[model samples]
Target chain A: MARVQLENVTKRYDDVTAVEDVSMEIEDGEFVTFVGPSGCGKSTTMETVAGLTKPTEGRVYIGDDDVTTLAPKDRGVAMVFQNIALFPHMDVYDNISFGLRLRTFSDDEIRKRVEQAAEIVQLEGMLDRMPDEMSGGQRQRVAIARAIVRNPDVFLMDEPLANLDAKLRVHMRTELQRLHRELETTIIYVTHDQAEAMTMSDRIAILDGGELQQIAPPLTCYNEPTNRFVAGFIGSPSMNFLEGELIEGGLRTENFDVELDPGAVPGVGVGDDVTLGVRPEDVHLAEHADSLADHTAHIEARTDVLEPMGDEVFVYLLLAEEVQGSMEEDPASSPNQLLMSVTPDTEIHEDQAVDVVLDRSKVHLFETATGDALVHGLTDRSDQESGPTATEAE
Target chain B: MSDRHRTDGGETRTDVLTESHEAELDRGPFQRWVDDSIKNPQKVYRAMFYVAAIFFLVTTLFPFYWLLMVALTPEGQLQDIIFTPNGFNPGAFVEVFQTIPFHWYVFNSFVIATASTIVVLIIGSLAGYAFGRLEFPGKVPLLLLVLVISFFPPAAFFIPLNDLFNTSFFFLEPITGDGTLYNTPGAMVLPLSAIFMPLAIFILTTFYSQIPEGLEDAARVEGTTRLGALFRVIIPLSAPGVATAGVLTFIAVYNEFFFSFLMTDGQPESWAPLLEGIIAYQGQYEVLYHLMAAASIIGVIPVAILVIVAQEKIVSGLTAGALKE
Candidate 1:
């Protein structure tokens, strides 16, 4: 296994930039996932690493070699495609042993490695089965087995589980983690699914619009996003963003006022525009305000819709009538809508007026003009004095 | 129903409605058939499908059956409307050999068709892969130009090609030592391969493109070069298309008559094809219909076997990309 590094790698397709000046060094034997939305350059970056697509401008190094111009076979990287691209004409044994056969390995050696890989993937006794005869999950196992049989320096997976059903996707996610541990091979995975990134990767390289936004461990990214895009993109039922302007003592949104010292936040002055960001789970009802170490004053809201998700309920609350009026055009991103998460047993209903408070430590402030995180926590902790509690700013 | 009608004072009204409903049910046979289709359509569909299939099968195979009947008829007893052979005297098959060097004609056709088909397949598959998978400028226009080659009839190139074959250009030599390709297998094989290459290219291109691109990428990563991927993964996955192209090219080249007649001396020793030799059955005065039918049947046996063996491949190839997995 070897560390894979991209130094200022930029790939362009005629007029459209697929990836731009993106650089990251993945430690040897670490699983690094490049996560982003569709057309967000995550897959392009991984392709550059795998030598499938040559970057327009920069060097890609694997171990000590600058493999930017190397052929894929020469780069010592094996890829598992999103479609689980097994040779449909070949049975499992042949598929798994394709690389070995290509290199003209001895028949006995090929068979032994094929069997070993099949066993690792739990595909024993399926050596004679054609790809068409196998289920999606089984085919995926065969694809992984195909990659593992080669024992390449790095395994490049481009959304290998995207085509599987949801249940199987989850199962394969755990299986991939187990495989990574057993093999201790460097794996560079690309996916748009946040859950997969959070669960599988040692670190996630979050990208958007052909640019790298952040690359850090899963929890670190979740707890401390570097920018508004990372803060918004890293979570499911994504973080709630309320557009507002900084006032004398705090921030003033369309509907409510949050009292805080303006001097506490960096890169923002009084009367400057800023956005308040908080996750759905961090928004609690006024009754649970005492549980929080610090919290914003209760803001009046009317429950718009309540989704009961077995363990917790997602309640979409309308912050105020005027806020709704101002965001009528883009209702999906309406600043008036505040998503609050509570336990399933909590009594809640649609159109019910309630008071909710934001967890002070969980709240994040972003520059409204540039979509960059300004401050993570607004609470004054004089003793700790670490500047911003949640803004690690990696 | 009676109690409710009586309570509502609508017994006469219910009688009128039932009479109209009965009237609606008394549809014509055609209308009734259509009505029954909506309730359970599979029965009618099966019957119609079987009828159409039987009709098609009979019409398609009638000529071969008639040829067999003619070939089996006793000499001079080939009468019109004689469905069965007048008598099962299989001597016409043996006499076909005595009439002319028919075996040599068959051999000549077989060698020429087989060689030309192999040439076409090798070139066509390579061109097909390039056209189907590779990205390059002028790809669309180049493919269209290849297709345009098939639009010209063989007769359009006959005179110029025959002239070229008869003479050596500045750098190029004649195919034969006689300074001409006449009466040689190269005459037919070369022209036939060129003539049929376009169709093969089109067929193989369509099939090759139907293979998922990811398979090639996977092969590339697995240490196979682009051409290696073509042979190891792409061609095998596209077996149906390659088979279909090969079969079609072989059959067309085997059955070709115009160029075969023009380029050869119409004698088996000079590599004349089966079609010309079959026509030679007509002597100075009398036409040997029985011998001709016998030769025809023998000539068709190879093609028939090829089609029979690859019928499934041809069908699947034609419908390869019609539905996605």
Candidate 2:
């Protein structure tokens, strides 16, 4: 196993920059996933490490050797392409044993390694089947077996599971993790699906617009995102934001007010524009205000739409009566609307008036001008005055 | 009403078959056939297909049949226009051999055609792969130039080429010590290969490009060099196209007469191709149409055999680009 490192690797195509000066070090045997939206340079960065594409500016090292100019085979890295590019003319045995045969391995050794790999992929008794005769899932397993048969220092997979059906994709996610656990080889996986990155990687590197935004454990990225982009990208049904200006004791927007202790948030003064961020689950109803240790005062809202998921219901709350028409025009894109989640059985209906409160400890603050995080949680001395742990707001 | 009283399942099965058979009998024979044909349009289509196929087969094969009939007719009745030969003269088939050195002509044709086909396949596949796969400066323009060269008439280059072969190569002496390459197999092989190259290149290119580039990438990552990938993956996968090119070049060169007749002294000893040998029957006094037809039929045998053997490859190679994975 070898640790793959990219030092300021950048790739430019004439005028467009595919991957800009990005650098990261992955530990040996670590499963690191590069996650981003499409065309965000995540795959480009992985290609650089695999020696498939040479970086314009920086060096790539695998196990202390600068392999920036090395060929893919010489770099000791095997890649499983997104299309599962198995040779259609070859049978399973020949496809899996291609690299070994190219290296002139003995017949006995090639057979032994091929069988071991096929067993790992649960592909026993399929050595004679052509690729065209297999299902997509089985074909991808053959591709994976082909990669693992080489026993390279690092395995590069570029959206290897993207071509499978949704149900098979989930199953293969578990299979890949199990494979990683067994082989203990350094895997650098590239994917545009955030959930895949979250569930499989030891460290998930989140990128946006050809730049690295954050690289940390999945939960760390979900809980304490470094910027507004990461905070908005990590969680599904993304976090909500309210653009407000700083007041003396709290923040104020046209629809509502939030009280906060200035000392808890750094680099902020009066009249500084900021965006208050909170997840859908963190917005609580006023009736359950007693459950929270600290919360903002009750804000009047009217339920606009109710989406009933199996386990929970998402309630789109209109914060101001006057802005209802504009938000209803395109509810999903509106910033004036607050989305709150409650139990599926909750007594809620569309167009019903409701009162909601924000859990202060779960709120996040970011610089509205720069889209950078200011603080993750808010604190107000007035709410702490009720009790040390819990408060029932009036 | 009592017919509704069914017994066991076996009785019902026999009743259903009897009912269908009775219905068939009720309908007139032609009507039943018509109904069945209407229900399955494929039956009508198959019938029409056979009729048209037989018509075309007769129209196309009539000339060859006439040639065989003429070959069997004796020279005494050669003036008569008869569909059937009145005299069964099998001796004319033997007479074609005794008259001229036809075996030497067949040998020359085989040598030149085979050599030209090998040269075309080797160069055509390499050029096709480069044009089909690689990214290089001037690739588009160069491919267009190759296509544009094929538009020029082969006759246009005959004068310049003949002069160069006979006299000198631009400012240097000819490769041959006597300053002429006439009557040699290389003379025909070189020109035939050059003339037949474009079609082979185009055929191989279409087929080669249709192959997914991912296969080559996979091969490359598995430790094969670029050329190795070409030999191991691309060429093997394009066997149909390569065979098609080889067969086409061989047949065209085998029947070639213009340069073969012009470059040689019309002698089998001078390496004249089969078409020239057939022309050699037209002597100064009288033309032997009987022996000429026999020689023509003999010359077509090899090509006809080749076509029958590789017919599937030829069809598939031509239409390879029309398919998708």
Candidate 3:
């Protein structure tokens, strides 16, 4: 097992910079995931770490050995490509045994290690089968087996589970978690799926536009994202942002006013514009006026589309002016519109006006022009005041 | 009662007519036959195809059959409209051999053709691989030059080549000595090699380009040197293409006659022009019909077998991954 560090590593292809000044540290025996959208340089970062591509500038160190100049084989790393690049000419056993044979291992040793890897991936029965004979899931398992047989210090996988079906991907995710626990090797996995990053990573590194946005544990990242990009990228149905102003009484919108913590609004005077961020689950339906009074803002909106998701009902609401136009015209943007996750037992109908109370405690504030979060002292906040933990959100 | 009965009678008559029409449709012999033919048309088409193919084959082979008949006819029995030979004599074969060293001539031709083919394959594959895979300065221009050279007529280089071979080295004439490649097999092999090299290189470069770049990457990651990867991975995967190049080169070398005819001076003892003597010019007097036919037939066999053995490679090489599964 090795700890990998990229010291301001950069990669350039002629004039286009594929990865720009990316720097992160992956601890020994840790499962770190590099997550981003397509063309965001996540795969480039992983390949740079594996020494498949030389960084144009900066250095890469794995366990104190500078590997920036080393070849992929000499770097002591194994990679599983997204295509599951199993040698089609070789059978399952031979594919697993290839690296071992390259290193000149004894036949008996190669056989033992190949079998052990096959057993780990539950591919014992497929040893004699060629790559073409195997299913996509089985081919991926063989690829994993090929990586495992080497017993390298670091295992790099480039979207290895992408080719499998949904159910198979989930099953393999659990298997991978178990494998990590048993083998205790440093794994740097690259994927575009945020859920995979959250579920599988010991620490997640989110990248965008060839730049490292944030690197932290899944819970820490979800609760206290460093910037606007991280906050919008991590959550499902993402955090909703409403452009408004910080006025004399509290956070003020054209239709409603919200109460804010004085400390949360520090250095902010009247007429300062900001965007208020809130998750759908945090907004509650206020049934009575007494309950509505506790909230800084209560606005009545008509439910245009109700999506019952078993545990919660996602009511798509429309404000007064927006309701007159059919729900088709900007359905999500009713003038006083809000999405509320309520008890499934609560009966709600389409075109019926209902009051929604926005929770001030869970709402986030961001700079209107820069899109950066307004609050700076999240490190000092207690666990309860932070956004929902990763587990709770999952 | 009268209206109901009348309607019932009319309905029964229409039903009877409809039933008869439906039955006629079911029992239509011509329609049934057409449907069956549509379902499995290969059976009928296959027989007709074979008959047509046989007719074409006979039409093409008739001239050769007639030539063989003339060759086998006795010296005195040379006449038109002979259904069958009165008797077959071995005199023509003996006279053909007695007139010249026929076996030596055959050996010389084999040596020249075989040597030319071997040289072409080696030089061509290397040039082809370089052109196909490597990035170097002037690659595009060089490729265009090669293609242009391939279009140059082979006979255009004969006089200059003959002069160069016959002349002594300008400065080293006293020590290295003057020697002429004229009247030697080198004359034929060397010039023919040059003539066929461009075509060989062109065919091979196209073939080599179709191999996947991923295999090379994998090999590099597995600690293979560039040369090692080329030999171990690329060459094995591209066996069919290489075989195709070899087959084409062999065929071209074997059939080449112009350079051999000009350089070897119609000498039966030399490697090339010997086949001409045995087939067309026997001591500048007469054509040995039987021996010439036999030798021509024998000469084509090796090429035919080579094509048959390497048919898969040639086909795949020419197509170059178009129909890859």
Highest-scoring model, DockQ:
1
**Which ranges of candidate 1 are over 4 A from the true structure?**
A321-333, A344-354, A380-394, B1-62, B65-89, B169-180, B285-287, B312-324
Candidate 2 chain A lDDT trough over 10 residues, lowest sum: A385-394
Overall local distance difference test of candidate 1: 0.87
TM-score of each: 0.86, 0.86, 0.77
TM-score winner among the candidates?
1
Better of 2 and 3 by lDDT: 2
Better of 1 and 2 by DockQ: 1
Candidate 3 similarity to native, TM-score? 0.77
Q: Model 1's DockQ?
A: 0.43
Off by over 4 Å in 3: A248-250, A253-256, A261-273, A287-296, A323-338, A376-394, B1-146, B156-216, B225-235, B238-240, B259-281, B312-325
* Candidate 2 vs. true structure, TM-score: 0.86
Residue lDDT tens for model 1, A34-119: 99999999988988887778899999999999999998899999999998888876788989999998886899999999999999
Clashing pairs in 2: none
lDDT for position A132 in model 1: 77
Question: After superposition on all CA atoms, how large is the RMSD of candidate 1?
Answer: 5.2
Rank order (by lDDT, best first): 1, 2, 3
- The two-chain DockQ for each candidate, comma-separated, is 0.43, 0.29, 0.23
A247 Cα displacement, candidate 2 (Å): 3.2
Using TM-score as the yardstick, the better of models 1 and 2 is 1
